[model samples]
Target: MANNPFKYGTIVQEPYFTDRKEELATIKESLNSANHLILISPRRFGKTSLILKAVHATKRPYIFINVQRAVSTADLAELIVKETLKRYPLERIKSFLKHFRIIPTISINPITNGIDVTFNPGVDSNILLEDALGLLEMVSTKKERLIAVFDEFQEILTLEKGIDKKLRAIMQEQSLVNYVFLGSQESMMTSIFEKVKSPFYHFGQLMHLKKIPFEDFHQYVQEGLSAVTTESNDLAKRILNITGCHPDYIQQLAASVWDLLNYKKLDREADAVDTAMTQLIAVHDLDFERLWTGFTKNERRILRDLATLGKLSSKDGYATSTTYSTASRMLKAGYLIKTETYEIEDPFFKNWLLTRLS
Candidate 1:
């Protein structure tokens, strides 16, 4: 039996992985250059995958922390130290951290068998963050190079004011450590890194990852299905169009298509895709409904306009219900993304929305 050519719902590696060659190269260069970078993309654009690939490619010892999983400043502090120890030697780490006094009280985490770096919750969160940065800086100097990737980094905005400034100040002292701040919340991330008021203003190189081009996505889909049947590439292109080239959706839809064809022995490729798409939308129905409930009446109208008109100002524009400022806010909030013009970021959401609004 042949292997499954598609992967979804998790990180796809190697032959299963499609593109992002340029992104992979840039991250490697940044690792060597100590280039702090924030990799921003809408969810499912494979930004995290590129970071992981670079971790393996770069010679520098690398640590990856998912910032969203951490709830408090202490959690963030504990996370940094724990992930770092996974790569560095324990005694050497303890010896190095002693100089910075980041984790003065260390005890083994009974659950994971890893040491937990405890700090006083009474202390200012900024101070705790500062100590964590100090520890990373000391380790970087000792190791010659250390790269830390903070995924879902925009969650830091949930903290108290000036956390951005404190972090920027902390990172500035580090000479050998490279930081990659990866985020899906584009608006929040923009405020943190692009707004002049943001302490992270101009702190790193900005990279806005674009959706996969039709040619690459189309060709990749074709290649993946090549072994199963002598199907037309047109069927693959339809899947890309259906998913708007959203990497995760494309992979998910494609995986389902492959299964219907190979497992259920569907005849026509287009029929198989149609069945797969129905299943895909059904699976995502609850998620779409949850998103629907979060919007205001104006935002809902805007989505309806985007679906029918494909741009603002058809039948009812945002200008009618809300100001252009509101539209801009939505863009920053990641409810919409602008390409040739503004549209719903999730193609599937637009489809579901049109059904309700129409």
Candidate 2:
């Protein structure tokens, strides 16, 4: 067990080790009652990690599938079959292949000793979906429950036009398997699940994953910092204040501080922390450039205004103004986050903007 407290931009699955206990309990309760669920959050907010943890804690057989790269029905079916067969025995897999009407072929490599199972596409794509559902239903019958989590579920909506309706129909017809649709990109996710006119409307429980509490984070960082050097509370607060409870940024900032501590055992005046923050921003220069590259001139100007002035509203305070509308759209797209007194998104980018503008 290393003394590392930051799991930057990665999934943490250990129950006793993670901090989202209440969210896990809510998911567990929903799964226990056979309720379908949709977990939503912004990018990098630990949705995948939380879903993986929930599936691990569940009292049923579960299959996890990542469809972020899937573009068609064929891709979706292939990924599902591949993950499902990984847990079954050869004989069972062969038996399963018969239900799919596709032969299960295995390949052996003499050099690497790696085995690969290849699935022959059946006569039609519908058969693939049917067989997948059948396999899940069969497993659920014998195992009491079966949970299938589709990560990056919003991508399914982008798959051809009618695919969303088709997939919804398949899930709606299922009586045994429980689905956990997990996705970031809050606006798209809401459109998929919350729109009354959509096929997936009212299909599952909506759950939003929030950032880890400040108290929990403070304790975690304190323990990690204590292991290296005796830093003051003010230093830790300053670091967190800049990161604003973003898990990835917090971990990254802490890792930078640890690297500084490695060189000099202690620094109590906070210069090391400040230097680490500066280096972190400098190292991420390309990220801001990429973000700016994707924006229109007006959008970029709106962002620049936020970066310079900290918040924005119409000069006339009218909701119908172009400024208000543009700002609202950017907020929904996750380009800006509106707080009580400020509008800032991506703390690192904000800091970078201040430095560049200054």
Candidate 3:
């Protein structure tokens, strides 16, 4: 089989996962106990993938809803209803919809060869929440726990009006379902989950999804490549050195390298891996550009500083110009990461910015 290890911008499954056993176990334990969870992580750290993997492993009727683009209560409700219906038979879905008082005008078209159901909220629009809750309750009453995973949940706060409060109330009253709130934007997630004044505060256990340990990831890369007869520890280390164990980046680089070495001799030279990493970045230039466009000037400056200084805080305070308040904000925003002695985040972007700025 061809070595196709890359899964950039997609969910990672079990066989493709590198490390994260402990974190996965924690999520499983929480689900087993019927406890809700909030997963917060920096972007591209595999938060979505991990949750998807958990959902697949749970062996339960679960609904994964991406609320990133959901700007209204109706959109969220519709998405949940649609995903729920997708998991069951049409008759069961119609029955469930009836219980929710969501009277979808059902019709069949000869061209489509499927039933079309359109919902109209009518006067009592707030009943949507009630109906959604009722549907979940019914699903739960079926002796199976329903898990609703809200990805990019921070977007809920972006709703025009006070929808967050309504969502909080609905989620609080949901006795039959478990909620998993996943957010890649750390600042938004923490504000929603950690701030006492926020409606979602203390609603669930807070969990952060971090990068897999370097050694374990290296092992996985080697083994995955070995399956296609193009394995090399040096290639794995070089990829890690550039991607810094970022799961998506690692997969992308590995995929590029695998394709490059298809039925050919492995590049054993020290600089060969570096060349491959460069090519990977060049091939995915548009992705990196889009990522860079999301950052503010200060955030970009912080990244450049890290790339140049090779660290955030040093004994001599080399990058000391970045004030404590700014650092804290950046850290909260996931633009910066702080360790006991070192501080850095998004190693790939840092390198890219540094190179561009220089």
Candidate 4:
């Protein structure tokens, strides 16, 4: 059987990556100019994939740091230094360490052939972090500016109290490095970058990534489905209709549909989508159940209404303002997305809720 023509749950490269022509051009321009960037998007919206694709096109030394992996300021610093070493050699970094107030203990790891950096316990982690970042700027030359991207950058607020101010201070002085901050949480990211009182106010060019436009994604899905089935257009529309053009969901549903057609050795069937949706929900039933149990009574009521009734109202002991408030919370939490109307973000979750209501 031909390999599945769809990919999801990971960074998608060319052939699998859908259209982002305008976004790619904008990011490439920003990187080429060495401008710091703040990219905000909802979860699983292909933020990482898009950023990595653009960064690779530059053909310059770059470091990717996911702020979520960082435990503390020191850990954040260590992560940055390690990524830097992977690109540059140790001999060059040692010269820059001599200027640090609290020098980190650096050693080479034999297993991975990579550098390991450690900071002393109880020392000022902020200083260690500053030095680590400075090393990047220091080592970079005018011709080769380094690109550093921090994913889940909103988590930095939880790391150190004044780290934002400290980061802004350090980033402002570096001219030879481009800093890119990416966050999945829109509210927190907005506060960090848009708020005047926040240290990152007007710090970089802000870019908000929305779902791939329907026309662009439709072509991509149809092309992939057409490889195996002749009824590709109808199947593509059905998948997009269910997924609302969600990038990750499109890949997942397409994968299932492909497997059902290829492995089951059946011709294209009308019920293929229904069967695939059922299988997808069955695979994620536990996660959906856990998510359902976490909601308050009113919250669950709201979700059930959206899932089954397709609309919610103020009646049935749920106040009008309360319903609005709950939905706004869900939208912000990534449970629902606002289109012409508020709907469950995950199509499979909506399907799962339908089963419960039935």
Candidate No. with top lDDT: 4
The model with the greater lDDT, 1 or 3, is: 1
Better model by TM-score, 1 or 4?
A: 4
Report the number of backbone clashes for model 1. Answer: 1
**Candidate 4, residue 27: lDDT:** 95
Per-residue lDDT over 1-358 for candidate 1, one digit per residue giving the tens place of the 0 to 100 score: 7767878767767876777788888877777775798888777678887788888876668888898888887788878877777878888787767665444577888998877766766766666677777777777764568888889899987755666777787888788788999998777887788998778888889898878788888889998877666674867888888777778878877888888877756767668777877676677899999988988877776777778778776344335445466677788778887766886787767777766675
- Candidate rank order under lDDT: 4, 1, 2, 3
For residues 278-316, write the lDDT of model 4, one tens digit per residue.
Answer: 888999999999999999999998898888777876668
The TM-scores, one per candidate, come to 0.88, 0.87, 0.83, 0.93
Model 4 Cα shift for residue 171 (angstroms): 1.0
Please list the C-alpha lDDT of all candidates, in the order they appear. Answer: 0.77, 0.73, 0.72, 0.88
lDDT, residue 302, candidate 1? 74
lDDT tens readout by residue for model 2, 103-216: 446666588775554456544666666666667766566346878899989888776677778788887878888899988777788899999989999898999888788888
Off by over 4 Å in 4: 265-268, 308-312, 339-341
Backbone clash count, each prediction separately? 1, 0, 0, 0
Error of 3 at 43 (Å): 1.2
Ranking by TM-score: 4, 1, 2, 3
